[model samples]
Target chain A: MRPVLIMVGREFRDGLRNRRVVGTTLLMAALSLTLALLGSAPTGTVGTSALSVTVVSLSSLTIFLVPLIALLISYDAIAGEVDRGTMLLLLSYPVTRWQILTGKFIGHVCILTLATILGYGAAGVAVSFANGVAEQGAAASFAVMIGSSVLLGAAFIALGYVVSVLVLDPRTAGGIAIGLWLFFVVLYDMALLGLLIADQGKNITTGVLSVMLLANPADIYRLLNLTGFSNISTLSGMAGLSAQVMLSGTALVGALVAWIVVPLSAAGLIFARRQM
Target chain B: MTSPSVRLVGVSKHYGTLHAVAGLDLELHQAERVALVGHNGAGKSTLIKLMLGVIRPTEGHVEVLGVDPAHHAFAAVRMSMGFLPENVVFPPSMTGAEVLSFYARLKRQPVSRNRALLERVGIAAAASRPVRTYSKGMRQRLGLAQALIGEPRVLLLDEPTTGLDPASRQSFYEIVAEFGQKGTTVLLSSHVLAEIEHQADRVVMLDHGRKVADGTLSDLRRLSGFPTCIRIGLPSGVRFHPELPAGMAECRDLDERTMEIRCSDASKLDVLRYLLDAAVPLADIEIAPPSLDDIYVDILRRMAAE
Candidate 1:
């Protein structure tokens, strides 16, 4: 535990000194503010009013920017240490490899959580002020978005860790991690849409979407947040019965919880046996 | 008569088809400063890794402070052991103080103790600066300081003086000497035989992943049988009959006044008497014993011949 804390402290200090955490936070904040202002412009979309625009912008940022930032922050966690030769120095201490991996995971999660809350929180406030919505609903939406974003971001970060441990070179680790994100974030959605098109009017029910949700944790986060808004719940319903099944209740929360645990545990196991 | 600080019983390590270390046996007693001398592929680094529990031996056993490094107790042993690898690089973002503190915390010890260690190793002033800004020598010093964390009972140093200047090297040895005074067992690997010869109490020579020779410097010199050469310059116009001692096998007169004798028994004072009785004119005399370099070269050559 002490070793883990030491590693965490070192990692946190590194994150701050490298300006990666700050830079990422600032970038997200800028994007969130831009999205909020644009959403207020009385645009020509299908019913994109001030409130809907603000909510959609926050949700979009949570879906896209959160996982990308998490991957960027954590993809180099292990391979970077090995590349710089600091892994040897760290290993020479009286700590196990498991401790190191866990400590890094926790450290990265902390940084991600802070950045997510602050970046998305500032954006949430900006949108709420622009839309003139009641503070209560806006706060609730902000809480849900940040909370689910953390869960989604943690899954991606652990995935990055798995990539980092499996790859020997930092650049390779980063490349593989980014490639994985592109597959899940962008390509997976396109593939799923194609599968729906091919299945055309068939019974693409709740089970199929549930399985797809399990395959991509990011989709589950977006579905959960989208389901929260009254305007998108009907569209989410038509997407699949799995969307309706997961809209509210134990299954939805349970599936999201599984998203956080399974990948992280696998990463931990891989890290335990890794040579470096 | 304390137990050996480190013991390796027929330890061997294999990487796939290649045997990095094979059937090695060694014992490092408490406070013994032993130098591990070898060529590049002699398995010196592999042996150190096994001792540190970084990698397990495929055959036989390795025990550091009587604990098997492959076991969980290896952490306890590691807490009391300091290691400096051949090439060391710390995290670029951490100041030297933070780096030391992080390691100190990893050892489950205090950072306060590392302050004196940093000063002793001669990197106190730069402790506040990030390690990336440090020169190679300063970085090496930081490594040395971290190695000394928790006052390790055994110090494993691999080419600890590689990037050090002459003054830094001298100061580094002084710190090592101090550690030895406090009963720290120091095991160092180096290709610089002369420098190690002055510091190590005993030398272990490795060639081709095997222990070729291990003993005191004098023991190795004796085992190699490379005789010490003594040159004596005599005054001009001094002539004497040439009858030398038995152990002094080869004697040659190089110039009009100088004679050189290769003597196996370096302590033989009778050679002086012979020269005195012969009425030889002695201008000046220079005695040169078989150095560690000579012993090392002789060992390598003998191995190659074998």
Candidate 2:
């Protein structure tokens, strides 16, 4: 446990030294602030609270941005070390492979946490100040959005590690990470929409659709942030689907946690068995 | 009488159809410096990896500090072991001090000691500089410093001085020698046999993933059975010839006033006695034994022939 914590400290410091922390935090903050400031302009006409409107816009933006930043930072986590021949020396230390994996996972998740909280938090605070006061329920919904955004980033980071350990080099890992991002965040939905169109709601009921959404972490994140809050759900147009979907917010968050654990465990296993 | 610091009993590592190591048995006593000599693909690095437990042997056992490295308990044993791999690298964004401290914390050693290690490796002046700004030699020195952390009981260095300058290599060997005197078992592998010839207590040669030769320098020289050469300098323009002693001894004129005698180790003294008895005015006499390089080549050639 001491060794694992030591490893985590080193990795986190590495993230700082290499600008991974600052770069990601700034990228998230800049983008979220833009969305928060501009996307909430329609609240004046829609009669919705400015913060809830910001949540709807931010959740939509996070589904694409957070995972991209997460994958970009994590795709090379293991493969880069192997390619640089540093992993050989690192492995020769007293730490176990699982400890190394766990340390790196925690370290990277911390980076994402910092990025999501500070990034979206800046946006949330700005919107509240502009709107004169924060509503109790809307503020709670905004907090959940920030917390779940970090979870969503963690899930993708875990997926990136799965790719990092499986590949021989970072170039291949980078290519695979992008492919996974497209498949989950973009192409999977397009394919699902195609399937729904082809079925014409015959065999694919809302229940099956909800279960299928659980398969991709991105959709789970979308469900958690966009539909978990009543006011935000109405604003995001997910109110109807949220009512029909049997999964509660806890179940969705659990599924996201599972997304993080399962892939991260797989990464640890593959890393342990790796010859180098 | 104490158990060997490291022992390998019939260890073999196979990657699919290719055998990286094949039925290797070896041992290193406390404080002994064993130089692993082999060409690329000769399993030198593979053997180190097996001992480090980063890769498991397909067969047999590897024990370091009395614990099987591949076992579940080896992580504790690894605290006392240090490995410096060939072409070792660190994250470029990290300063040299940060790099050493990072490894120090991982080894559970005090980071405060890393300052002395940096100075010992002659990299203290550059300790605060990012690793990316360092030269190859500086990086190699940093690698050695990290490996020396915790004063590990077992140290494994694979081609540790490949990029070092001659002076740096000299200091590197000095550091290694210092550690060896402190009772640390060191197994260093290098293609530069001449560099380690005088440094290592014993030499182990690998060929095709098998141990082909293992012995001290003189022991290998004797086992090779190669002749020793004696060069005698005579008076200017003295082109005299003399009958050599019995046994496998050959005499030939190298040039005017110089004659060379090649004789087996057993007959070397006999030939020298004959030279003194002949009353030949000898200006100089130089005896050269078979070097490790020559012996290594001969051994490899013999293995190839077999």
Candidate 3:
């Protein structure tokens, strides 16, 4: 436990020190603010719907951005150390491979969580101030969105760890991580859209959407946030179906949670056997 | 009984068809300063990596601090060991202080002591600056500081002095010597034999992944059977006679006034008597033992001949 914390602490400090984190955070904040202001302008029905639209739009953005932040913070966690030769210094200590992996994961998770909270917090405040909905109810919705984003981010961070261990070079790992993110964030949805277009509305239903949600944690997070905002019950109502066919709240959350555990465990296994 | 800090029995490591280390046995007692010297591709790096648990041996066993480095228990062994790699490149964003503190945290110890270590290694002033700003020597010093971070009981340093300045190198050796006095067994690998000749208590010489010679410097010299060289400067007007002693294999006229003799045995008085009999007037004489380089070359030559 102590070693794990030590490793986590190191990861946290390193993340804070990284210029990439600072630059990414600033870029995210600027984009979030710009979107918040544009959505809040008093124009038409869109202006009145600004707060809802911003919340919904940023919810998707958060799904994409949170993981990007996580991967940026974590994809080089091990490979960078190996390349820099600092891994030798760290491994020379009396910490187990499991401890090192867990510690680094925890640390990265903390950083991702912090960035999500702060970046989303700023966006939420900007939208609320512009839309005049800075009350307790909106705050609660924002909290749920942020929580879901954190879970989503954790899944990606673990994925990044897997990438870090699997690839020997940081540049390659970064490219692969970003490429995977693009797949899940943009390409997966496009593929789903193509499938729906092919099915024309006859085959496109909540069951298929639920199955698609299971395939990507980012989709599940978006679906959860969407349900929180509106009465998307047709999607939620599928819960009454058989346990295996239906995606329960517990199961959706569990699958996202599994995303956090399995990849990290696999990375630990690989790292333990790695020569350096 | 206290176990050896490091022990390797018939250890061998192979990379595909190339054997990096072959059938080697070694033990490092507590506080012993052992120097590993070999030419490139001689397996010195492989041996250090095996000790650090970075690489597993293909054959035989390696125990570091009484724990098998290949097992999970190796973590405990590594916790007490410090390693300095040959070429150290740190994360560009990390400050020196942050780097040290992070390593300290990874070791699960307070880093209050690391500040002094940073200062000791002469990088305390630049602790706040990112490592990108540090020169090669500074980076090497930082590597040394990180290696000393938990006051490790066992230290494996590979080409530790690669970029250090003379003053820093001197201080670095002093620090290593102090660690040795504190009972920290140090396994240092270098191609610079003379630099470590006086510092290492035992020297292990490797050639093509095999332990060609292992003992004190003098022991290796004696084993090589390299002849000690003597230079005799004859008085300006004297010339050498045709007849020379049997043991003296080669004689070269260094100058019109001087002749140098290569003798198998320098202690014999017959060579001098023969020079005297030939009316070779000698002005000054110098006798020097074979250096480590000479002995190393002789060993390699003898092994090749065999």
By DockQ, who's the top model here?
A: 2
- A1-276 per-residue lDDT for model 1 (tens digits): 777888888778788888878987898788877877876676445553454455656777777777888888788888888888777667777898888888888888888888877886787777666656543444555577778888888888888888888886899998998898899889999998898889884978767766886678777777766666555444334344434545563465567778767777777788777654
Over 4 Å off, model 2: B231-242, B251-260, B272-286
Chain A TM-scores in order: 0.88, 0.97, 0.84
The digit string of per-residue lDDT tens for model 3 on B137-239 reads 9999998998888889999999999767778778889999999999999999988776887889998989999999899987886788787776787677777
Q: What are the TM-scores, per candidate, against the unseen true structure?
A: 0.90, 0.95, 0.88
Cα lDDT for residue A20, model 1? 75
Candidate 3 CAPRI category = medium
Judged by DockQ cut-offs, the docking class of candidate 1 is medium
Comparing 1 and 3 on lDDT, the stronger one? 1
Instruction: Give the lDDT of residue B130 in candidate 2.
Output: 97
Give the per-residue lDDT digits (tens) of candidate 2, residues B1-306.
Answer: 889999999999999999999999999999999999998889999999998988889999999988987677887888899899999898898999999988888888999999999999999999999999999999999999999999999999999999789999999999999999999999999988888978899999998899999999888988888888999999996666778745659889888878899988778888899889999889999999877888888888877897
Give me the overall lDDT of model 1.
0.80
Task: Please rank every candidate by DockQ, starting with the best.
Answer: 2, 1, 3
Better of 2 and 3 by TM-score: 2
Model 3 chain B: weakest 10-residue lDDT segment is: B263-272
Is candidate 2 or 3 superior in DockQ? 2
Q: What TM-score would chain B receive for each of the candidates shown?
A: 0.91, 0.95, 0.89
Single out the weakest 10-residue window by summed lDDT for candidate 1 chain A.
Answer: A234-243
